[model samples]
Target: MELGLEVLGFLLTALVMIIEGIAVVMSRRPMHSILFLFLLLLTAAALFIELDAVVLALAELLIYNGGITILLTLAASIEPEEIRAPRIKPDIILPLVAAVILVFMISTYKFGNVSNFSYTSLGTFILSGYGILLLVVMVMSIAAALSATYMISKEDVGI
Candidate 1:
């Protein structure tokens, strides 16, 4: 029963990931594409969690979903209101239905039996070994965002 549940979870996550990925590519508007990308990253994180890679899942959520998606959304919003495409009414019902189904699936799955994964050791390894690399990446991302913002502001000011 547990194995069957795991397989089902994996399949559902995979299906969502694939659909969101295609949405990301096919979305006409920049904001819509970014939103789909966020969903894709979220499903990928969920897949990592199902595979018992808790640290990886967390990293995916923090770096891609939390950081990159926000950056892209900010960049997309830089477009002038007059030049941007007309807003389309989003399909709220579909997303709400999907969320409900996902919640139901999650509620039925047993999460207490998660394997003994040592988060502390993994943290220690990441900080001790690749700390500098992580720091560099974070700094670069921040710098990129700031530069993009500055450019947008400069354009607005006729600079």
Candidate 2:
């Protein structure tokens, strides 16, 4: 039963990642692509949690899914529609080159054996070190959202 559930979880995670990857690349609208990317990050975070990498999962959720996703969504919403659409057909070479570089980097990397990699409890570490930073980030995100709302609500002279 447990084994079956684990297998199901893994399958679902892989499916989510595959779907997100395809959707992100095929999406024409910038906002849609960003939304798909956010989904991808969320799936990745879930995968991390399943693997018992809770810290990594939290990082993925808090950083990419929360911070970067919000910023990208805001930018997409604020940008002109014409600019949001690709002006030129994307060149294949750039992505190909990037893929090659990524593959090479991954293949050549060496993860040295760590005999001891200990971490403090998440609660302790957060409260001792990152607690204040987290609060500040939350406040900043709220401020940004409020400012964006104000900017959008303001009457445009050109409109």
Candidate 3:
């Protein structure tokens, strides 16, 4: 049935979102965390799509994945290799996995049919909100990038 298939897709995307969120937070490496965070945002967009909020979904995809993650990655690139932390503790990894699985299981249950397209309804006038959001995300991304660069560049000289 169409409803069943839609629900299944939604559940799978939702599971991916939760798992990626856990991975992002649990990963010890900053670069890895940023990468997984990007994935989490993408999966979140997919979940939004299933719920029919195309506007919000696209916004998440563009702002988070398309802008912030890219900025984070750029900043991470400048991090000195020797200063980066080592691997994360397995003790934390195991519990994160368990939490992810539990979340997936609980979210599988059927909920109200959430299927409505938002982006398509906005028409050309969407330029207004779209433009504003784009400008804001760009400004924030730039600020984050500059701040990261400043942090990495700062250091106290040895006496």
Candidate 4:
């Protein structure tokens, strides 16, 4: 049935998100972390699609996975030798605390069914009433790309 498939999709999305989060936090290399973060963004986009938020899913792909991830990857590659050096002492406390907080939040919240909201109406509002938010996201993505390019080029000549 359709309901069973929806439930399976939700479970798969949650599982992917959890694994991606762990991989992002655990990876020592900047590029690996960025890759995992990109995967997380993709899984989030999948969740948006499952909820029938087509516009949001597209924005998630284009703005986040496409723009921000590329910027992050480029920035990571431009890091100095000292910046890429491994830490003498790995700090695990902050990540553990964050994980605990995330678990607590998840356990305490009640997740509502996606059918509770009308996706069509949300899409209409996004396209009509709150179209400016979409524009802002695009502008921000462009700004991030431009800044990253400038910084990388400047640092190339030790400027």
**Which candidate number has the best lDDT?**
1
List model 3 lDDT by residue over 1-159, tens digit each.
566766776766766677667777877778878867766776676666556676687789788888889988988898765455646554555456445544543464245544543254575655665878877889998998898677768875333
Better of 1 and 3 by TM-score: 1
lDDT of 1 by residue, 28-81 (tens): 788877887877777777777777777787899899989999988987898754
Give me candidate 3's TM-score against the actual structure.
Answer: 0.54
Tens digits of per-residue lDDT, candidate 4, 25-116, equal 87777876787687678777777766667568789999998998998888788885334543322245335433543453344334663555
TM-score-based ranking: 1, 4, 3, 2
Score every model by TM-score. Answer: 0.67, 0.52, 0.54, 0.57
Candidate 2 segments exceeding 4 Å error = 1-3, 83-159
Which pairs clash (backbone N, Cα, C closer than 3 Å) in model 2? none
Report the error of model 3 at residue 90, Å: 15
Worst 10 residues of 2 by lDDT: 108-117
Show how many residue pairs clash in every candidate, following the order shown: 0, 0, 0, 0
